[model samples]
Target: MLSIGELSKRTGVKIPTIRYYEQMGLIDAPERSSGNQRRYSRQGFERLSFIRHGRELGLTIEDIRELVTLSCHPEKPCGDAHHIAARHLASVQARIAKLKRLEKELKRISILSDSGHVGECNVIRSLSDHSHCETEH
Candidate 1:
């Protein structure tokens, strides 16, 4: 068994975040020592590791919950996990596409702008006049 500090250190998750995960039901509540301090098992360590990796991958809390639930049933099909991953991939791709458009727009604006007074700034005029942009911001 490990203390809360030990678990936090091992998992690289903060103490409050560990408590928040417990509150969110992402992790099971740990057993308490006679002093009423939380004592975690190796199982907690593994679960927290899983949660940290999921968060790093930008998985939603609910998505992580579903994955955790699915993990508990070894006999269950992994189609749900695959679906979650696909959905996330699609979202990421959409954001990438949007960012590319923004990049093009910024480049266009920068190229159009000449070093002039702010009163006659091409950048300001282009920003005010949406017709200057071909992309839908």
Candidate 2:
């Protein structure tokens, strides 16, 4: 058995995060010693490692919980995991599309401002005019 600090060190997870995981029911509660100090088994380390990897992959807390549940049922197909990844990919794609539009708008503004003063700047005029942006649509 290991102390909470030792478990944190072993898994590269912060102590408070581990406690939060416990509160969230991501990791099972550890056994308490006579002094009420948390004592963790090797399985705790493995569980924490899984949680850390899921977090690094940008999985939401709820998604991570579902993935952990899926991990326990290894006999089942991984379609659910694939679905989660696809959803995340779709979100990233949407953000990229929005960013590309913003980039185009900024480029248009910058090109129009080349050696131009603010008083007669097309960039400022565009900024003041919401009708000029495709994004406002």
Candidate 3:
């Protein structure tokens, strides 16, 4: 058995986050020691590790919950997991595209000369008028 602190150290998950996961039903509540301190089983360690990896991959809590449920039935097909990953990938791709557009607009705005006076500054004029932007950000 491992104490909560030990579990956190081994899993690289913060203590509060581990508690939050327990509250969210993502991980089981660990057993307590005789002195009332939390003691986690090996299963708890593995489950927390799984959650950490899923979060690192940008998987939503709901997605991870669904995956955990799917994992319980080892005989079932893995198509649902694949579908969830595909949806998240599409979302990431869309965000990347929007970021690229924003980057382009910022680059265009940054190159304008300020002319040493706000009244005659191309940068200020461009900012005041959205029509000057080359792309919708």
The candidate scoring highest on lDDT is 1
Off by over 4 Å in 2: 97-132
RMSD of 1: 2.7
TM-score of 1: 0.81
Clashes counted in candidate 2 amount to: 0
Better of 2 and 3 by lDDT: 2
What is residue 91's positional error in candidate 3, in angstroms? Answer: 0.8
Instruction: Indicate the residue-level lDDT of 131 in model 2.
Output: 75
Q: What digit string (tens of lDDT, one per residue) describes model 1 on residues 1-137?
A: 99989999998999999999999999999899999999999899999999999999889999999999999997999999999999998988988998998888778768853667889876677679878555678
Query: Residue by residue across 1-120, what tens digits does model 2's lDDT show?
Result: 989999989889999999999999999999999999999998998899989988887778999999899989999899999999899889878889989988988887778637868888
Q: Say which prediction, candidate 1 or candidate 2, comes out ahead on TM-score.
A: 1
- For each predicted model, how many residue pairs clash, with residues at least 3 apart or on different chains? 0, 0, 0
Tens-digit lDDT track of model 3 for 1-137: 99888899999999999999999999888889889988998898999999999999899999999999899898999999999999999998988998997887678777766556877766667668877555677
lDDT, each prediction: 0.90, 0.89, 0.88
